[model samples]
Target: MALGPASVKNEGTKEFDFTARDFERVRSLIYRRAGIALADSKQEMVYSRLARRLRATGIRSFQQYLDQLESHADSPEWEAFTNALTTNLTAFFREAHHFPILAEHARKKGGPLTVWCSASSTGEEPYSIAITLCEAFNSLTPPVQIIATDIDTNVLNTAAHGVYPFERVEKLEPERLRKFFLKGRGEQEGLVRVRPELRQLITFKQLNLLEGGWPVQGPFDAIFCRNVMIYFDKPTQGKILSRFAPLMKPDALLFAGHSENFLYVSNAFKLRGKTVYELNQGGAPVRPANPGKLEKML
Candidate 1:
């Protein structure tokens, strides 16, 4: 997903002639393609983000653009359509608490650990996991493998490259900067590249969570599927979580977003900590948060 400018108006002045029907069509298409439950409040946000696509395609209006999308269902533009609408706002250690648990798991599991970062927005979370694993093993080459997948093809391309602005890493300690990243020079100045050690440990791919079957082979020790669930309705969330359970080891941990409370959505997982969950056996206590009911998501 593209995290475009905050301003809703084109050139900070001209507003796209968006209509209620246009918003409804776009919302329906996005839900069908990406399983994102865009709220009615996001109408303006939808217009702002997709306005660029309209300009690029030389389409006069959202209605026509949407008509084109529906007519050409298999076109490459379909991917771009989903990419523009989905949210990709993420950063390194956005949920800092989850890393320590991952580290602890790495220590306990000893050699050859596997993890899946289910929402690899521009690759920060997976890289952070790689760094943690490297630190745990005290080597650039750790006995860990990470698979980072995201629905957005555009972001996957960026994540695969493993390059970012220097400011993105400015918060890290100097020692870590030196150990895990290479400072770019000359034309590439003010940029940092994740070291080959870290990059090699991760396999980045594009994956839509709503797909019928996944290409990944897993009994992963942990899965970081945070933030993305907020866009899904309760039933969709529950179905996805059910699919995750079989792919994960019985003792595997699941890390969720701050706002997500899966206790009411599914019975398969028990809350282990703040936004952390593990597969429930039989008598785990019930603790459901007041996760609001699913809106007309589909």
Candidate 2:
């Protein structure tokens, strides 16, 4: 009996035969396609997320879906495959302390400040960067330029749309709400839109960090790559950090995720603050953190 789409059991809760080999194939493919390292623990997550792909293609098993993926590496399904597997947990002002440091940097750097929010999941992080710039410069049209990039095309589309549920921005100060977002009304109620002025300051693009070349120039004042390195192994993280280091000025800052510690991974930066690092000569000491948890993530 040949494995084909007809063999699929699309009934809800139907168990697909997901084997260890299937998991390893997916792990390797995602790493090659986008430089994300899936841990051994992510097996269930991998199955749960890509099971939808199986259903979508009417393919019964993980092996069939992965086979389809390998056969059509350039297909739209490949994009969907990468998107489905990529994690995207983000919010406005998440890791709020970073923004204050960002605001201060923008103020000191003066006009036309450049920033890159490398993991701009669901648009909030880049939009927050834009809002911080607006407040720092005190203008509806702030003198700042931001490039927001993400590996997942799905989230990039959402970021470009710049719409969010009402509750997403409710925690923001009323002043910021009035200044940067338009409350949707009538048919569009219960949602908010990022003000055009704020949107203008940002450019959202789809980029894979492991790509040989980026489409944008650098020498940026700051780069917010938070919460992303936790998904990669130390060597992969170090390679990414090395690439990021050159794009920034010597005084530039790199904001890392809460659980990430780059000290042992990359010697290009020194610890400046909690989860913050400044690019300097080399070999800067890392701040104290729970080494056990950090090692696991690294």
Candidate 3:
């Protein structure tokens, strides 16, 4: 007799009775709520993360916990469930090449500019944008606005605080260190905080892309949706990319992750440079690139 999904069970000696069905249920729920398609190989990972939720909610089995969640569509626990499964991986200037492209675009635009960092994850990416523009325009305050958003509320709270361990920025150049952050002292030792000016340039909020209502308005100069679409399936990626189309200006630039090739996903954009994209003009005799991709002004 061959084994089936329902017949499989987690190996012996566990705190909770986790089975293949329990994992499948989790996969389905998270996929519906967040558009994340968890793989069968992620069974161990899923059990580990949600095991704490089971303890906190005082549920004996995964079945009971999931039953509770499905029973109440509006339950606050849904937020916790979503947050537990979401992954946030980020760093300052993560794909270093994109920043130079951004700085140049901002200079050419030469006016009040707006950019969106759709996956704001713990805030480093948006702050990096602020820092780039500040150096580009030679002002602590620049004529720019950045709206940074992410699905994970837990990370947003940390991002809003603007405090981080010193080790996080130690690798940054000495000039960048002095110019942009204040070293923590006394009781806050070993911590560094982003300068107030950078924080002022950003507005952080909770956003779920899978949901219908997006709270942002844009015909933005640039939009950074880097490294986020890898979590969603192809159909979901296409839907999100189509929505991003109407939100972009005719000449707007889109920055994507190095490993992400969106050419297959939508025709609204085309490759401009490595991992960087711009709106497709459909051969309509668009404006020249010299005005848009100019040499540094400072």
Candidate 4:
């Protein structure tokens, strides 16, 4: 039967059939594809986005549409399915404190530096890192590169464009804002783009944290995987941590979400402070019982 524009609810029930089984299926598919384990509570969100597709295609039930999706792997509907479910909440310098710490580490190291923004949603975090580097080292004599990655292809494309609303640029200081961003004009009013210099410093790509054999080379000096791990299960978190440990330099720094802690994950790194970890090089490692005692060196 052809589906109408109105949302479909199952017989003798308040919840849509799509709301029941499809939600769980979508959640499983997301975890399998992107390693993001969504809570069962997000069923409504899944229903809402998928229901839009149903209306657009005039499909009556989620079951019929899901069958079509499975059969037509190359369809645009499949692509939309992936895009709609991913979260893309990010801001330039969302956590301002991390940038200064990163700057200090880069300046202290004083040579070729490679920084990875592992969960760089829409490119804000990595660009912030690049700006901090530019501010720290007045000259670009020493080579530095920022690698920004996200699992969502839609956001990666947006990030590579480097265009954002003017409001997003307002977070920067006036001088830095003028220096780093170009105000959109004429047809592009209300949008701003990162200057070529800052944009050039970042390499954006699509990467799934759950997948094996990372596409980019590492031995990175620092990595910012902030606010991304809260969606993962502990086992997945542990696996990701183990994978990152070998990719980092001996004294490399790892930064995680404020809500995340690595104490139970692994002993590969010593806690330096809240959500900050220092790779245990040759020195004796000291594990702090509480994050409070660890100094914020930056």
Steric clashes per prediction: 0, 0, 0, 0
Residue-wise lDDT of candidate 2 within 227-269, one digit each (tens)? 8888776667777887888899888889989988888777788
lDDT of 1 by residue, 151-202 (tens): 9988998999999999899998899999999999999999999999999999
- In the range 1-298, model 4's lDDT, one tens digit per residue, is 1223333344555334664556556666666666676664565677777778788888888888888887786787765776777777888888777878888998899868998899888888888888889888875333788889887788888888999999998867998888888999999999999988887888898787887878778899999989887777666676788788888988789998877887766666778877899876664443323322111110
In order, what lDDT does every prediction score?
0.85, 0.82, 0.85, 0.77
Per-residue lDDT of 48 in model 2: 82
Please list all clashing residue pairs in model 1, or write none if there are none.
Answer: none
Error of 4 at 276 (Å): 1.0
Instruction: Quote model 4's TM-score.
Output: 0.84
Task: Assess candidate 2 and give its lDDT.
Answer: 0.82
Candidate 4 has its poorest 10 consecutive residues by lDDT at 289-298
Off by over 4 Å in 1: 1-16, 283-298
Model 4, residue 287: C-alpha shift (Å): 15
- Global CA lDDT computed for model 3: 0.85
Query: Which predicted model would earn the best TM-score?
Result: 3
